[model samples]
Structure formats: structure tokens, C-alpha cells
Target: MNPTEWRTYLVTQESRSAGRETAAVVEAALSGGVDAVQLREKGRPARERYELGRRLRDLTADAGVPLIVNDRIDLAAAVDADGVHLGQSDLPAEIARGRLGDEAIVGVSASTVPEARAAAEAGADYLGVGAVYRTGTKDVPDETNGVGPERVAAIADAVDLPVVGIGGIDAGNAGAVTAAGAAGVAVVSAVTAAADPRAAAAELREVVGDGR
Candidate 1:
């Protein structure tokens, strides 16, 4: 439940998995020793996402890793996920906490010190901050995209919650994010689209370890 301890966090996206199933990608990541997983299959039907979440929940639970659902508290509850991660445009963290209860691990995306500080005030357990490098994995605001490590350092210095640097991060640059003060790194294609996801995750984990 401690995000600061999640050195290697994987955000799932089947489209980026080189035609593999989302479950398959996650299975590889788990074996690669990912510290946590987030189910982030945006644009899919609710039933489809729920069924996938069910399978993911089982995998992560067995692996003893936390499984977080993206932007859907009900889906998280339906699949009995470990928590929910919300974007700025999604539900407020406080309302999400109210529905999920105080024990749930609620996180919100942020790219600046103000956003990070606001999430802290809203009782978020952690902050997903970045585009520390350019990203195409998800659409991001131009103003915040590629904010870089210095922005990460500012947010970490400004907020009290753990910060998970995401966006465009890979084994090559993950260290910069952590060196800048992120507690962990959250990545999609770094593991999902790799020819060998297990090895990709392991390499990124190794880099993050060195940085930490």
C-alpha cells in the first residue's frame, strides 16, 4: 500500500502490447518483478474492462502486488482492485476516497507543483507526475507535457505525498526521474510494447534501483 515502495510500476494498455493480450503483458511484467500494476485500458467497453480487471485482479493478487484501476472507481470495486488512479479531468480524489473508503489507495495525476499540492490537499495517497519526457502513450496537455525532471523535483519538493513519475520513461531515462525525487516510475510502452516485456521491466527496475 506504500507507493513510495513501488520502484517499478506498470500501466497496462493492450493496444501497445504488440498484439498480445493485456493479461499476457501483465503476466510477463509480474514475472519480471514489477512492484505494482495499473489497469488503464481506456476507450474499452465497461464490461470488457471489468472482465479484464477480474483476470488482472487474480494475477496481481496471487503475485502479492497491488493492482490499481485507472479512472474508474466502480470498476475497481467491481473487480476488487487494490486502488484507483485518477486523471485531473476525472473524479475528485476526495469523492473517490469517500466511495472507496479511507483504506483505498487513491492517486491523482499531476504535472506541476500547484496540481501536486492540490492533490495532497484532496487527500490523495500519491501523485502520478510527468511527461518528464515527451509521450504518445496518452494525450496530455501541451503546457504540461515534457515538463522534465526539474518539474518533477519541484513537485516532489512542494508536495508531501509520494510522486510516481510517468510518461515517456524507460530504463534509459527512469533514473533521471528518480534522481529528480520521484519515489517510483510508472510506464506503459517501456514494458508493454517491448519485444520481451519481462526483460524490459527488469532493466527498468535495475535502473530505478540505482537511481533510488
Candidate 2:
């Protein structure tokens, strides 16, 4: 899928929620209008992560949505995923692009304008920019405070690629991110941890529409 197509993104399956299976949650989210799904299970064994990536690739493919593997280029290639999302410590976007080739999508995470600009120059197809609100969804570093919606706007302005706001995003604040110039919002707990993942995704999609 093209970067512009990522209007409602879901970063997934962190084993923290009771009775919330990753495959089930992804299926539900897709049904409710999640445009893209990022398989982000960092703590799992490689075999487990690969198996889940394969399952999600099939699920997302069936839904005609892009499935992006987080921080694992090899896993993504193995599963034939649509793309891979890279963090600052991961392989550079240009190198990933070289390995994945022109047809594959590559996204990089950035919290500041310079990072966003550098990612753009490195040939990233899109940018994941935030910590837009205080989030415990991922293990963030001490120096990285939530940059908020204003930072999303700043990063968007600094780069030509599509930008998706991530971290602590939900239906309530998703619209604000979109209004601040993010092409989309990426969420983890908001959808993955919800009692009704499908309903939660739908609600967030609705809120994003209001902002657009």
C-alpha cells in the first residue's frame, strides 16, 4: 500500500491484554476500517514473532490492507510483508529500502523535525512521528518526552512523506492528531487492549474523519 493510504493504522498484539489474541484483534480491527497493521511484538522469540507475522500478513492481505513488521526487516522479508517500520536504532531507511527494493514500503519513526527530515532523505516512504501523548504502550527512553500534536505538525512540515502520529493515541485524541496534519494515527493499546477492538477501531476511524 502507498504511504498516503495509511489513514488509520494499528500497531499490535502486545500480550498485555487479557483474552486478547493478536490474530483476533487484527481481524476485528480490519473489519472496522484499520487501513494498516504493524506487527510489533518485540519481546517474543524469533520463531513466535515470525509465525505471528505470517498470520498477520495473510490476514492483512485478505483485507487488502498493508501489514508492516516493526523493527525486523528479515522477518518482514520472510513473511513477504508489505513493509517494515524502523526506529532510530534500527537499520537506516535507505539500507532497508535497498534490501526491500523500490516496490516495498519502508517507514521510519521520528520525534523531531531533524529526524523526520533525515528519514525522508534516507528514502522512507512514510514517517511515524510522536509520543503525541504520554504513552506506556512502548518502552520509550527517558529523554524522549511526548512531543504532542504540534510536533506532528512540525515534522509533517519538515518532510514530504506521509506522517502518522503514534503513542497514546485513541479515538478522543486521534482527531487532534489528524487536525494537526498527520495523515493518520497509529495506536496500540487503544485498539489492542479494548474490550471491543472492532468497535474501538470504528470509533477512532470516525473521529479521524471528523478531523479530515
Candidate 3:
């Protein structure tokens, strides 16, 4: 499915999974209704991440969900993942699309209108825009987190590509992001750390659906 049609996107982080493996959490999330999945095991050895990506690639394939490798085009190709998500610090989107080929989905992370427009012009298939609320998913600085729905609104208006609001989003607040015009919302702890990842994803799915 095109990410433009997704209502919920899941970014994996095993460290916050409360002991479950990343693939396990992702499987549960898929059962619950995630439209897309991203393998984002930062700091792990390349071999380890490749192994995990292989697992995720299989799971997402069987579920007919797109699997995106975070910040690693080579790994995405290695795992035969559906796509790659690039941070501003990562390779340029044109380079990603060029290397991954025309059929590959290329996404870029953006926090502002200028960044969003740049990404769209750079050949991004979609944009992951935020740290929408204060988050602990990573060491996000105070200024980036809590940028709010207004940021979503601004970026959404500035770009034509689908926008997925990320960071600190959960069922309770995901609606705000979508309401502000995001095509979807991406979450880490909201599902990965939940006691029941499937139910968390299901609830979030419902919220995002309602949000639209």
C-alpha cells in the first residue's frame, strides 16, 4: 500500500519493547492493523540489524505491509525491504531513489516547512515530520519535541507528499496530528512498549481512522 493511504505507521525500537523482540512486537502490531513497519534498530551491529531486518522483511511481506529500513539504504537493499526512511543527516533523497531504483519508496524526515518542501523536491515519496510532542523515544532536544499540531499543519500545507507525524504520538493524541492533515502517525513506544502491542496498535488504528 502507498504510505499516502496509511493511517498508522510503526517504527521499531527493541530497547523499549519491555523484553519482546522487535519482530515479535512488529508481528503483533501487524495483527492489530499497522499499515507499514520500519526497522529502526539504531546502534546495533550491521550484521545484527541485517538479521532482524530479514525477519521483519518476511513478516511484513506475509502481512502485505510495507517494510521500511530506517536511515540505511544498503540495509534496505540487503533485506529487500520495500523502502528506506532517511533522516536529514542521512544520504540525500535523490541518491536514495537513484540507488534503490524507481520502484522503491523513499521517505525523508522533516521538522519544518522548508525541510518538508526540500524533501518533496528531493524525491521523497513521503515525509515523516515531527517530534510532535515531548518524547523519550530518543534524545530529542527540547526545541524539536512539542512542536505541536501546528507544525504538522504547516508542513502538510507546504508539501504535496504524504506526511506522517512521528515521535511521542499515541492513541490519545494521534488524532491531533491527523486532524492537522497528516496522512498518518508514526509511533515507537506507543506500541513497542505497550503491555499488549496488538491492542495498542488496534486502538491507535481506530483513533487515526477517526481522526481522519
Local distance difference test, per candidate? 0.93, 0.88, 0.94
Error of 2 at 94 (Å): 1.0
Stretches off by above 4 angstroms in model 2 are none
Task: Name the regions of candidate 1 deviating beyond 4 angstroms.
Answer: none
What is candidate 2's TM-score against the reference? 0.97
lDDT (tens digit, per residue) of candidate 1 on 1-212:
68989899999999999999999999999999899999999999999999999999999999999999999999999999989999999999999899999889999999878888889999999999988899989898888789999999999999888899999999989999999999999999999999999999899999999999
Model 2 per-residue lDDT tens digits across residues 1-212:
77776678999856754477799999999999999999898789999999988899889989999989899889989999988999999999988888888888899999989899899889999999888888887788655558889999988887888999998889988989999999889998888889898999999988887887
Candidate 3 weakest ten by summed lDDT: 137-146
Off by over 4 Å in 3: none
lDDT of 3 by residue, 1-212 (tens): 79889999999999999999998999999999999999999999999999999999999999999999999999999999999999989999999999999999999999888889999999999999889998888877687788899999999988889999998899999999999999999999999999999999999999999988
- What's the CA RMSD for each of the models? 0.7, 1.0, 0.7
Model 2 whole-model lDDT (C-alpha atoms): 0.88
TM-score of 1: 0.99
The TM-score values for the models, in the order shown, are: 0.99, 0.97, 0.98
